[model samples]
Target: MSLSQQRRFPRRRTSVGASRDFVTGVLIEWQLHSLIEDIELCVSELATNALLHGAPPGREFSVGLHRVEELVRLEVRDSGPGQPVVQCPDDDACSGRGLRLVRALADDFGINDHIVGKTVWLVFKAPAAPAPAPAPLTTPGSS
Candidate 1:
């Protein structure tokens, strides 16, 4: 089965934690334990970036999750003006590490630019499904 969900949040500092919690809850419901940690971290980074650089005044950002087969996709949309870029921060810098972390953690990462805003997306390759249990053997005349 496939599942998809999207949620919007105001451009606030709290939205970072809220986005992480939302992703954790959905991953738990979907039984994607293996991906919870990595995905949560990626979501947090993206959400924080959205709140810090992407969201304009009085505008909101959105997060979306889609699971189909052995892959899961995550997205964060913000009403910002510019596309996000990966930066090479100085060793002593305090900021500019979020996109780098996201790129390192996600299997695939990209930005979807629109006329109004942009959507930062990440894709993860889910764990393989477990093997089915073997059938029990029956005697010829057991019935």
Candidate 2:
């Protein structure tokens, strides 16, 4: 198994897009293409929430990626005070949809509170291993 690496960035609304791109790039680096889209979506939404409502402007945030035996965990940490409340929305509600989407996409999701900020985690099953390379074909009429 590959070792896990983590990244931290400032908590700015504009950073949401950048964070998603960063996570996608990391997934490519680790050759985890199957989980790229799901992870990117989750990371983007969670990071957006952290920047928009979870914390104040100019505060810092973090993104951590861990690859275990059969799962990959994505976490977005922010220096915000409040915990994420996942509420089911009515048909007319316009807001409070991010966490719901998180729960839907992630196999398992949760929140963790730190001394200063909080971390939102989303976990998905790791992609199945790529099929082994096929053996070279032999020619019947080889020289």
Each prediction's TM-score versus the true structure: 0.93, 0.85
| Candidate 1 per-residue C-alpha lDDT over 7-102 given as tens digits, one digit per residue, 9 for 90 to 100 | 999988998999999999999988999999999999999998998899998999999999989989999999899989999999999999999999
Model 1 C-alpha RMSD vs. true structure (Å) is 1.6
Model 2, CA-based lDDT:
0.83
Off by over 4 Å in 1: 137-143
Quick one: RMSD of model 2? 2.9
lDDT of 2 by residue, 50-112 (tens): 778776777778888988877888988888788788888898998878888979988999888
The 10-residue segment with the lowest total lDDT in model 1? 48-57
Whole-model lDDT per candidate: 0.93, 0.83
Off by over 4 Å in 2: 131-143
TM-score of 2: 0.85
